[model samples]
Target: MTEGETPAQVGASSVDIKDVDVIAPNFKKRLSGVTSTIVQLVPYQMKLGIRIATLGPGLPAYLPHIRWTGLFGLWRPPVGRRHRIWHARRNNEMLAGLILKYVLSMPLKLIFTSAAQRHHSSYTRWLIRRMDAVAATNSRSGGFLQVEHTVIRHGVDLDLFHPPQAQDDTIAATGLPGTLLVGCFGRVRHQKGTDLFVKAMIELLPQYPDWTAVISGRITPENKGFADSLKAGIAKAGLERRIVFLGEVDDIRPWYRRLDLYVAPSRNEGFGLTPLEAMASQTAVVASDAGAYAEMIVEGETGACVPAGDYGALRDAICTYLAAPSLAALHGKAGLRHARDTFALENEARSLNRLYEALIG
Candidate 1:
């Protein structure tokens, strides 16, 4: 199955129960980072002969999946294999794996991937302890894990995000104001540091009239007031036309290519991917030291990293590019090379397949 296939055409029934070697469970209903990871990686893993299938709802039809009723078939091992690997990324999925392996006495090996940098709760620790294997999305996540785990950082789809054919043409297509564009994308909330980016732009954009700042992300109902306040601040700064809010975009790849610089001022993250995505788009980045931002960036080469939540540092970082846009192009070239050689999705898929194969063996 591939993109744009209908559910009827790529239904779970089409995939044989005996062929599945790994079950990647996504218990969440809403779209999230975890869901995005599964959607992006599964097709690659399948191409690499991992025989993995998702076991949950809310996923796209392009993925190989097992229906909820298919859980009954777990009583029998897949083909000649002794057991299947149950890979979980959430607490509830971990519980489901535990029940499948222990409660039901199924032929399964449980593996959990952790991305949180914070220490685990007792309940979460309990789940990790019972897993047959664990993987962390980054070094910081591994540090927070109680069990031994492999550090397999997430990777970006290079095909989806690459350097623009013509930077000026891409920027013109956006129809946004200004010759140079800097962007901060994600949820518009305090934790994401949307206000910090806004405040920094409010202070910097007037001085550097050649640049425009763009923010693109979802604004939930609860955070409407927060988004409103930021807009109010932009209005008060008299830079409303200069600093624009793009809300949530359908495809952010073109937007990344349009950018001369990208700022990811997130106060916190569970292995942020925007910096790498920007790098893949041949755009330089200025990101806070959150999630795997530090791990991904080459620091001063691809871009710069500052202490998370530091407005002074963020403003200074953006000002560096605004003062000398040529520097952004230089760094952006380096960023594209780094992203291609280091953070390609194929690398991540192979690393994960090795781990899954080892567990199955």
Candidate 2:
């Protein structure tokens, strides 16, 4: 199966189920960071001529994916290959792969990608120990793993997210009210430090009338009150007009390109990708040292980094960029160069492909 080949089409066609080279499983319905990574990477891998297909649900129907019923087909050896690589990102997926390889006696080489920045649970550790190979998203995440693993940092699609050719026109098209736009994106929740970004903005936006802040993401039902409280604070500060919350835009690349500066105030993350995405868009970043953010940003050159949950440091960093617009431009250009040179999506896909080949060989 390839992109645009639906499950129905796959069923109707003469495509052989035994030819899949890799299986990337989702398992969960909600769109999570892991799902996003799989969605972004699989297409590139397919273009590279890797026979990859996503399993499980919640992904776009158009993505190259096999039906859940395809699990039985794993019992047979893939044509021209001794075994298929089952790449699992979550414990449940690892467990399923284990069952297929062990109980069903399928010829599958199980590989796992670990992105969690903290210690794993006992069960997860056990599952990790059983994997044929493990890949961590960063050096810090590798430190948390009990087993030996390779560090493969995530990358962004540079073509989809590039420097804006016309900055003023891009901002105007967003319909956001500001000559200078600073954006904080991700889920609107306390753990993500959305409140901290709001607090920092409340203090800074009032002083700089030319600057406005935008928070774009989904606020889940449980976090409705938290979002409302932040809105209330903005109202109380009398800067409601200065700050805007454009809840979860489908295309966030433009939001990144239009920003004068981008903030990733996550208190916790599993290898945060927002800062890299922002840098790919040629936007300078001010991010907390969460996930692999400290590793991603070249402080003072690309962007600044602060201690997680330290709103004072965050405010100071944002203030420095706001005070010196020239500095922000320099950082943005440097960040763009850094991202393009180091973090292209093809680099990541090729690295993973090599690793997959080594395991299978």
Candidate 3:
């Protein structure tokens, strides 16, 4: 067994631990973007009978996962293959896989998926260099990588996130005020442009009294003061009732459906998924030119794309849709069609499976 792994720690049943084709490792205990990707993708892969299993902490128990003790079994040849695929999305996972393949002599083929848009450090570059094959979430991300890699954009689960049957009833059920709703959902922080979203709402909500705005996300301890400051600003404008802060919610799908227009004003991102989620929910989006948002959004069709960190441009984009509700509805319908036709979750799973098959062959 690997260091720190004991027989008593093996959580998987003996039957569940055997004959795994792909080992998706998530080392972080916290739920992050990387962890979310694993959580979404693995189940779909398993549904296709891929024999995939996750290795690490934090994933939901419902997902098929083996414990640390399962690492010992990797020393032997995988069923019907010389090596199994170790898909790592983080630096630590790659390092662990490197040790298992080289130091411990496990029959494993390493695959690293990168979503970072910025330059990589020397250490990260070295780890990436050792990978047998690499996958980038977008074309821009692939350009930043020094090594050759396939560009595999992320896809949303169309079944889970879709247009609501009754939009008004859905919003009224939540008990949030306003006939019309627009939202910016994600972690409330400067980098995420949460403040900009609030500022834009303050300026615009007064003219459109029938409409309201919402911010749904967490504010960490360090950013608690920042959040308080936004609340203070909203109170100062006397628009607290109109612009609501839901904080964090368990399921964000309902929130997306309730929104007539969705805004992702992030200053930076690593393949942001919020816009895609909104689109899949048949909500028109106004996203900043961050991450792969521009790639995902079709200007004037699916949604509008604004310059990052420009609140004025963001304000104007929101106004354009607010003034023309029909245009907004048209965009929403187009977005739904675009999301289903282009970004289906099954497509991504099948593509990855093809890659795995090619590598194994």
Candidate 4:
């Protein structure tokens, strides 16, 4: 058993509240980008002997974590520490930290990582002011913050997402048609611009018969009708077989490896990571100018970026690669190099650890 694991708690390493130096709270029940980051990062932080543990749901079974009941024990500081750091990614989590520190008088230092690229609401601005420290995923997000913040770009796990060991074999296993693959992976919604990708593919794929387009992600209940309409459009264009949708993939790393090019067509995002993930997988990307995508891709060098929600620009940008497969391959190699040097997951963990150490000290 780990430091705090009891006989009743079956899965996950539950760290003792007293021993924890940092508390990373994931309040959301759904699987979001924030939740995914906490899951991937906590284990890395623990391996570095940071004594950080996750709090709340949506995490895997093996990462270090504390039960919700552990909140009761927060009144006292952890052993060998003046106060424990409460690291929050979302507003609700930040609010909870404020409550714990101000209302409950817990020995906690509040830290909030802001990824949003929009103007903060009055409520959000008020909350950010109370934080002991802040982190912005990129420069633009930092610009949106009224308070000072450290800019730390999110990164991908290069080990998990890398150049395909056997690209042809991986592609064949998927049973998807075509020699070259273009994919858009995320939730299917208008804001995500799934329709724009589909429209671009409809117009482009028929000319380039060897290239297939894949859409892999979940279509939530509210967006089911929207997804259905896209399918209908695909069918009308007689490109049903050419364009595939693999819904809610279990492990997306392999899927990234199989692609020649990846598309992130979201109209808006909170520090998008798919382009970085695709870049790490040695896949060229054509992402929209959303989130931190413009900062990620080097235009013609690694990949191309189109104006968000611009159908004509999206189509033209994709056609640039479809017209020349060699260019995509060349960009893919450069993307791999860039991802390795600038966006390794270890880099993100180490950066965050440095921030945590400052606060904890």
Candidate 5:
């Protein structure tokens, strides 16, 4: 606690634990400024550490010692920043946060992933400049930050998220061999701009033949109304013929394989993963300009990225590519190349390894 500063912000999530699977709601409830999230992989933290350390003590040299949590304690915030705030929205990097406050207080160099978080908060806007380096998951992420950190594109298991081994093979059940199928994956929320994706397709389907949109995602039980609303929109748009809702699936490969394009119309993001999954599946993408779209998409090179909430722009992008399948294929190939070059797991681990060594030094 800093001098004259109030206690931790109300609703702020706990900063103590790095285990994503066990994140507590009370943590965020206690700190107003913190946003809590679960990444689903913390139970394996200690096991992974032992494995890494076994590979050689060198492995943990740069990375945080598996037991550092006990030393640092939890949720340590700035001492004098009278109004320390948080903007937590995470899918995979919860562990990074455990050391964030400590990082802020030090002069050490660091690689900040999840750099493409979308926010207009004055506090967040101010903090971006204070970062030493950014670890942008996509080019669009790099662009929005207005600073070039490292271009570490998001990763995917190419071997797993690919099309049928034979590109020309008939996947009759999917109707993808002869038909152009465009898929949209991830959460089904208005903020994801599901309404806008449907509207864009509704307007474009009249001109495009042999094309359809497949949306796959989990509808929160509390947000069942949101899913229902999307269904209603699809019906109103008369796209009951052109759109397919697969709901949530435990494995996404089958869904990824039967697609020609992956579209994400999120109004905001640090980096949306579905499009990357699409790219990994050798499918082209058309995403919103918000977040990392600018960095990941090369306009006409890899995939198309358009501004969020703009139905016209969004529709035009989908149409332009749908009319030319080769263009889409080319972009998909580029995306795969880019992912392999920078975002591979080995590269991230290597970078993380260095980061840990530096931290402990």
Candidate 6:
């Protein structure tokens, strides 16, 4: 359902079994109870609960079963019938809710993966207020509320994302070796600003011959052509040696380790995780002058913040950093400190745990 729809209109039935005897205290653990039995147990079930229950054996029967789940006061009336709002933009909308579900779902006590799901129109707000609480993935998201919300920082795994004292193994994979590595890494998609970065790199490389552009990440089949286009631009500008497209790698920490700088120039964001990761690795960053970057970057104290798609400005910003390696080092160290204090895995986990406890309590 679209974010603009009402609870019932969006599929949130006003018929939540108000007297639920068995509420899954923890959303993560309760998620496992995907059975018809779950619906039967709820004294007063919500349509959302019914959706969760009917996944296994109920799936075969539940599609048709939902038609009759909301009859007039059936004693056990559709025990777990829920009207849940399910939204996706092009099937893979990158919202705060979606990111939280993917990144922290395993350890989470609750799940709410809808980017700006809460930022619906006034009509939608009436529907959303029915929920007990709203969980926002970041301050940018959480602060925007018609009601109460809990802000939880999304994070990376410290164990697997180990930074190296030496350069990462990813350099060999990136193929832009022996040069000053100024890189961008993530899912090689439009939102990451691959096009803008490529343009910036091309404009800057003539003067800074040794500087490299390492675009690392997977180019989905739909966007592989975009990657090709980037390659063509690199060639046309005679920047083949300066730009490297490491299609996709299993581990990317090495790429971060090898980088002289990391850049994220997205046009918009709820919170950008890549810069935090780069900072955690003691790498300097040049992120877009858009949402959440202000929370994470300093003009030149922690990292540089460049405009989203301005190649000329990005090139100049890169030059500013390149001109002073010591300054970059100082900013990188500051960024690392900020990331640790604000976005580290432990800090995130603790913040999440508090949210869960509040939810359960």
Give TM per candidate.
0.95, 0.94, 0.95, 0.95, 0.63, 0.65
Clashing pairs in 4: none
Better of 1 and 5 by lDDT: 1
The sequence of per-residue lDDT tens digits that candidate 3 reaches over residues 212-301 is 899999999999999999999999999999889998998788889988899999999999999989999999999999999999999999
- Roughly what TM-score does model 4 have, to 2 decimal places? 0.95
Return the number of clashes found in candidate 5: 27
**Model 3 spans with C-alpha error above 4 angstroms:** 1-15, 167-169
lDDT of 2: 0.87
lDDT of 1 at 97: 93
Model 4: per-residue lDDT, tens digit, 153-215? 888876567788874426777887878889999999998999999999999998999899999
Q: Which of 1 and 3 is the better model by TM-score?
A: 1
Task: Name the 10 consecutive residues with the lowest summed lDDT in model 6.
Answer: 83-92
Q: Given candidate 6, what's the lDDT at residue 297? A: 79
Residue-pair clashes per prediction, in order, are 0, 0, 0, 0, 27, 17
Candidate 2 structure quality by residue, lDDT tens digits, 196-231:
999999888878877889999999999999999999
Instruction: For residues 1-361, write the lDDT of model 6, one tens digit per residue.
Output: 4422223223332224333211221112221212212332221123223222211123222121222232222234233333222111111222322343335341112233223523666644544454445656557666566777667655543433445464344455555645567888766667778888888888777777667778887777898888888899889987787788877776567788777688887776656667877887778898886556656776777888877777677767777876776777788788777777776555544554444345443
For candidate 3, the C-alpha RMSD (Å) to the true structure equals: 5.4
For candidate 1, the lDDT comes to 0.89
lDDT of 1 at 158: 83
lDDT of model number 3: 0.88
Sorted by lDDT (best first), the order is: 1, 4, 3, 2, 6, 5
Q: What TM-score does structure 3 among the candidates reach?
A: 0.95
Reference-based lDDT, each prediction? 0.89, 0.87, 0.88, 0.88, 0.55, 0.56
Which has the greatest TM-score? 1
